[model samples]
Target: MTPRKGERPPVPEPLPAPVVDAHTHLDACGAKDAADVSTMLDRAESAGVDRVITVADDLASARWAAEASTWDSRVFAAVAIHPTRTAEFTDADKAEIERLAQQPRVVAVGETGLDYYWDYSPPAAQHEAFRWHIDLAKRVGKPLMIHDRDAHADILKVLTEEGAPETVVFHCFSGDLEFAKACVERGFVLSFAGPVTFRNAAPLREAAAFTPADQLLVETDAPFLTPHPFRGRPNEPYCAAYTLRDLAALRGDDVAELASAVSGTADRVFRLRTVTSDLPNGEGLR
Candidate 1:
């Protein structure tokens, strides 16, 4: 039977089932309202993205991300001051972040690290703020999510000197093969993002191939860095399939197996065990 003229069209068939988006920013994305949030989650859920770790780079966004986590079992929160915004970091801000980190839904302590590309904040300040975040992660016994952009040496030095939490994740890892080897040797997880799917990102693809099985993860870094075939458009958590496919190709591994492995890595690093039942689909929650 034909549908009514005012009736809504059926949703598209969902992507492959049981995919996990290791990193994203649900609150900062298009989900500014309850309806928008629900729609976004529905899109992701329909795409087989069972879970996402929504990250916030500032206090206000952190609160929003935390609240979003409460609104949906599929969402989790990662809070910290982005390196570019280090000027806004203060003791009180740290306190608030620490408090949020103690919350049941908060997973990791970053999206924080050095960003020499913009240099929005002084390098020294970025380093100082990064150290403080590392300390906070240690104090709370949570993993650290690092963001390194054109500051690989400095990042390595800081992590080696100040010492990172037991679990350190280098999100959107774009480093060279040597850096990838070093990170693997140090037992740090390297999370590949949309850039890895670019044709010109051969170096990143090489790094992706070098990441050890247990130390590899995948993310969308959404609303930005949309993977190939979808570049130049706003990214979303549901687009993580591109990254997973690229990583699997680079490593010559089965896509399904790699996807499941990275999901497990994310689960362990983010302490998803404590919040599995609260997660959607009963997959990769712990």
Candidate 2:
């Protein structure tokens, strides 16, 4: 059945092998509590997105994201004050993020980098916060997930200047082939999102094709950037299956092979763990 205007695109068929939604925003996707989180993951699981990393964009969301990870084994958390939201970033906020970064279910310190497209936060503040998050990721021994927008040069320069963490992910990577090559050279993982499937994103497609399999990952960045044939409609983690399948077709790779590569890359970069009922809940988080 055809989806009508304003309706979400139907869930795509499951991948031959499960893949991770490398980055998403469950809180923004209307996941208000544990039950909502479970429901969202259930949908994602049905579509072959067996796990997700819910990223935080602000203090409240950061807190919520951390707690939400504890609600489900399939959901991991990445805590940070988004670059655009750093205008009034406080020390207390930094302290809390640091505390949350240590949580067992919190997989990375991320979605933190530059967004030159928006004027919501001053460049100076964003730079300062980016540096701090970089340091935090390094200190916590976790991958640093970046949110680079129109500031590719600055993002690379800053990471170089501050010394990048052991593992760095360009979350929802939006760059041309040149930028992709540069990130590839630095061993930085590029996580493609729904926009890569857009009609106008030829350069993005080229970049995605160019990224090495080991450094390649896929994501939804949910509630935004819904894939082609569904652009402008609301997005959710389940939509990752659509993006992954599209990526396979575009790159001329076998769906199962590419899905396996992406899943392994996510596992390596994020150091993901399968959450079990016996595992401590929200351990080491204050």
Candidate 3:
């Protein structure tokens, strides 16, 4: 069956091996409820994108993502207030997030970080909220997934000053080779999205190239950033396969090899134990 009118991009071919979508927003991607989530996961699984970390950019979505993870064994959640909404981040928001952060299904503490591109909130507020998130991540002992958009320098400074959590991921990394190298030097993971596959994204492609195998990840960030041929259309978790395949092609590595590598990295970073559950629910294949 073809995707409906709102869902413009139909499912593409399955990947050579299974992988994980390290960052995405189920609500933003048009999944209204648990049933919609299952449908989205079905499409993703069909394309060999076996598991996903559905992220939240606000308190309501964070609540939704936390609950959504419980709907399926394959879905996990990351909860946080977005940089663009820092001004709105309040005591109530922090309290709710604190409660949500403790949920077993919630994996990382993020989609948090600075976004200088959009000034929806004052810079001072954004910094304050970022500090709060960093502390929350450390308290919860979960990875911190960052959303750096045109604020790499301040991002580095803030993380350095606050002392980053044990694990940090640069979600939808949109940096040049130098920025990429700087991130890599600090032991941060760079998660590539649809932009890496664009015809003109030579710099993003270059960063994807020299990135360490174990420190790389893939995502759709969809209902947005759809890959290459599917750019300008609605993206879904299934579309991550396109980005992964494109990365494999760019690096001249075997598709299956790259898939396995990223999958393992995602498993550790998100600590989504079900990631390797492809074997069986019980003690089947280790």
Candidate 4:
């Protein structure tokens, strides 16, 4: 069923413990300035999502994401040229992305990888750009977050060919049991989003259940993929709390236990730290 446009999902009850949103898009969610960022994170914090990593899809958003990370201590950023937007990638663009990748507040290089579901960019162009982003992640010593949408095999293939970064994350992971095994075997982090709660996602549930707690993460991918019962509605970082509850129920694990595992994994993988204290008089990132 399609939710009416502009229909926002209700904020869910707080989790038993705090959890980080491994991925979200604050710019797309209508956050224009520090106040907007603060208000958005305040809702998320109230729902037990105390932190988040806002990911960028292109250069403009990448710049915005890096600056947004400074707007609030609860936020971190990941910058990359998404595969679908790589058709016209240029040297200057590459340089800028590399620069952003090195920023202290930018925790990862991603929302990168193949997206065969869309024809917005040709496969060859996407392949070339994906390789470049893979190398950038390695060079910067940061985790690589992937966006595999119907290109799982090629995504794996390229990572193998390019030599993945020390830490890798399959954001909004969309694979089955066997693919999940492949990622787990290689020690790749699989970040589950709202789709695992969908009624038609049994295979996804199987994959989620099979993922070791240490290799697992949860996200909202906000402004999209709102969890079931609230599917088709607008999503935000707070909705990550709802996804966590459903994931725990689906995996038959204790919510607090899973939340702890997820939180620990996020801290370790992203090398996250308390940055709000770094802001001058708590004035936010400059």
The 0-to-1 C-alpha lDDT of every candidate, in the order given, reads: 0.81, 0.91, 0.89, 0.92
Q: Tell me which residue pairs clash in candidate 1.
A: none
Encode model 3's per-residue lDDT on 190-229: one tens digit a residue.
9999999998999999999999989999998987899988
Top model by lDDT, which number?
A: 4
Best-to-worst ranking by TM-score: 4, 2, 3, 1
lDDT score of residue 56 within candidate 2: 94
lDDT of 4 by residue, 195-224 (tens): 999989999999999999999999999989
Instruction: Record all residue pairs in model 4 with backbone atoms less than 3 Å apart, i.e. clashing.
Output: 70-285
- The deviation in Å at residue 256 for candidate 3 is 0.4
Rank order (by lDDT, best first): 4, 2, 3, 1
Q: Mind sharing the TM-score for model 4?
A: 0.96
Pairs with backbone N, CA or C atoms under 3 Å apart (clashes), candidate 2: none
RMSD of each: 5.4, 2.5, 3.9, 2.1
The TM-score obtained by model 1 is 0.90
By summed lDDT, which 10 consecutive residues of candidate 4 come out lowest? Answer: 273-282
Query: Native-vs-model 2 lDDT?
Result: 0.91
* Candidate 2 lDDT over residue span 120-232, tens digit each: 99999999999999999999998999999899999999999999999999999999999999999999999999999997999999999999999999999999999988998
TM-score of each: 0.90, 0.95, 0.93, 0.96
